[model samples]
Target: MPLKACKMFSNPTSAPKAPSRYCQKTLHLLENFKTLVVMGDEPDREILKMVARTTIRTKLYEALADQLTDIVVNSVLCIRKPEEAIDLFMVEIMHMRHKFDVEGLVLDHGSRHPDMKRRAENCFILTCNVSLEYEKRIFLLKCRAEGGNGCSLKASGR
Candidate 1:
């Protein structure tokens, strides 16, 4: 008499694709991304509306698309930091918009600087915490060196 034994193994590489009914070629898995979702006072259904059709409801938040997690927001901060304030309370500094990247510099409460038009087609923007006069002095010197008109010949404050 003889006894037979066999072992079976499954392939890890052949794992099931996500959203089986959806696209199998491009699985929008967040395996490599670092994400954080901040729950505001809004109900899940309301928040879900802001989410894009391409994103899974269980996954990333709309503002946090492209790994730009706006962070796990606190309710009061959410009230204070929405894109637009209620008609009663309007303040620029506290109102954060989803249009811009969180890591990018916002520059002076988003107020327009001097020598800039209400609508500019092409322009350069420079920002610093120092006094505008200091920046003006630097700009004046550079402009003079480049033979550009309308700039002071000297650097202020020796």
Candidate 2:
């Protein structure tokens, strides 16, 4: 069988559905992580959260049950080359809470253009790197502690 077919058989749970703009990419990311997770064995809590947020948001969008992801995607895509600060993004996402749930967010911090770096840095300053394991856990706990906390599940569609 072909590699893609083999993978589909091996990891049916993470397979992407057709007519999905993100399905194939999501499954590919999961497969790549599956390999990396076992070697060196350090869990990238941030990345896992990123994937989860991406998956959930994408599904939420495709399902059209909520417009949260659509708003975030629009805002981020609208930002020029670099990007705006995380808080700005969060605020934008927060504004759409009436349309969807914002339970937890995972900001992507990979290096890129100056604008991208600025965006990530701003996120760090805003959330104090809450996407990081320890801080992220605290953020989750605090959200749960509160009744209607809006968490930004940050992830780049790239």
Candidate 3:
């Protein structure tokens, strides 16, 4: 029932010398979970699309076909503002949990915003920074969006 928020490197351009260690670590970390839920920002649309089409989606289907019975993998980019984006992402996560019974949530750029801290307050938090040279940072929030009559869910459902 604990939600984990991890802060890591965001801007990839600064680290020209080496590839993103955060990304590699995050991918490896995701493999340990049974269900995978991914949330990415507008900037990460292409990367998310590649992941959805190639590996994660396929592997999830192969391992937990029954669990994803009604799940829909949406790869559309529509939102313009940061707040709206997070709201939509959370709603999607909730929907996947309630309608499709998803066990994992993978948020790419969705967790980078500072506003997410308020939304993910109840969950566990882990802050990690690779270097200070990077001007921007992104976060990864992982939590089980439990379905029920919870206030947050009720509010978002509306």
Candidate 4:
């Protein structure tokens, strides 16, 4: 369940056959997963470094993305910084958005990348924490609540 094993990657038009030992190991790790893999080619080396750093720190993201297929089938992926790396993740989602059932996204705080907001129009943008989780739960409840077209979210016991 390492970041390298998450299989998050980008597909270049003409990638070198024999990549570096590190890239090769990362690629092999990524191929073993079934979730959406997000990556780009321009910053291949940087991304590799990030993955290495993440593996050294913790494998939470990789593990979550790997087993996230069980949560909502489709997902609402939120990448902290998606400026130059936006397209990499976008392309991956575009390819599988139809095959799977990606509902939307909630880009939380700490993302200073400007383009992230503009480019991420494809998904929802959630800026608040409490509101974000509340909205997510409401969305799920709405999905499950049959004939719930005009449901209200006012505070209870008002």
Candidate 5:
């Protein structure tokens, strides 16, 4: 796919509409930022939210905030050096003439994967756990891949 420059965008698969099934399937509860901001002043928002959400882990919650905060920093950096973002949108057309150096499935939409709940366009995924080549080091502790392709990654260490 051709790379198109944008002023801002983090999710290549971000939907065009609200209450998207694709998004809801990935997340338990999706709320507009406006809704969170509207409950202003009298009470603290983060504490109230954490109390209401019994299952959310403190570290994970903080991570999300950290990621959102990064958008601003990233955006400024990208704007200053936009040429770096050209590799952000990726797609492939396979044939005998040209081929990917690595073996991996490239699908047009996220929903094309059996495990995904809904469709997404221009999605981008990155994995840093294992490199392009096979892993060389052996794990001292028992560890296994969390999920197959077309699924969410869920891994933990004991």
Candidate 6:
């Protein structure tokens, strides 16, 4: 048995006009098996760069605003910080969930793991992080904030 796959580029103008010979051959070979084709907008370099600096929680909320039912936010409290603030926040969140009859609570942990995938099958788990390739961006921002040139900071490996 053979399957043929057909992909429809949402933006026809963005689709490559002529694929390479290797691509044509691969497509020809796959013409007899079941194939699933997914189409999406090409990644934007500027958006990708911005995402690298943004936190996972902010990105998830922005992307899934309509679908999100409940969210649990965690914060660290020191002795100088008011414990009642966190308690009140949790109480308010619980009240909101109860009033709205929220369906699911998504936990954003900022990193991925094997257990995360398993837990995601049962509940929503958000895993997103600033990739190592973008570490330079963070460093540059810190350097700028400290009134130092980013290039010099990178050269010094600080």
Q: What's the number of clashes in each of the models?
A: 2, 5, 9, 1, 0, 4
lDDT to native, each model: 0.40, 0.43, 0.43, 0.42, 0.39, 0.38
Give each prediction's root-mean-square deviation over alpha carbons: 22.8, 20.9, 21.9, 21.9, 21.7, 21.9
Candidate 3 lDDT by residue in tens digits, 1-158? 11122224445565643445565566667767545444544345444444455544444444353333223234234323544443434445322244443334444433365556555545766667654231223344444558754342222222
Model 5 lDDT tens row, 2-91: 112121323556654432444454343333332443333334436444443423233245555454433433432333333343232433
Identify the superior model by lDDT, candidate 1 or candidate 2.
2
Q: For model 6, where is the 10-residue window of minimal lDDT? A: 71-80
Model 6 score (lDDT): 0.38
What is candidate 6's lDDT per residue for 12-125, written digit by digit as tens?
A: 444454333345566677676634432233323344333333544344454543233122222112111332322324332222333443334534344566564534455665
Q: Give the worst 10-residue stretch by lDDT in candidate 3.
A: 1-10
Model 3 spans with C-alpha error above 4 angstroms: 1-42, 54-56, 59-75, 80-158
Pairs that collide in candidate 3 are 3-123, 3-124, 37-104, 37-105, 37-106, 38-106, 39-106, 39-107, 39-108
Identify the superior model by lDDT, candidate 1 or candidate 6.
1
lDDT of 4: 0.42
Candidate 5, RMSD to the unseen true structure: 21.7
The residue-by-residue lDDT of candidate 1 on 1-158, one tens digit each, is 01111112223345443334233222344333534545454435334333432342235454344333223222223445345432324423556555764533244555566776788777776765653321223423535446456555665566
Model 6 regions lying over 4 Å from their true place: 1-19, 35-105, 109-129, 132-158
lDDT, candidate 5, residue 110? 24
Q: Give the alpha carbon lDDT tens digit for every residue of 9-78 in model 4.
A: 4334335433344566766776775445455443343444444444433434555534433332222123
Q: Residue 151 error for model 1, in Å?
A: 50
Candidate 1 — worst ten consecutive residues by lDDT sum?
1-10
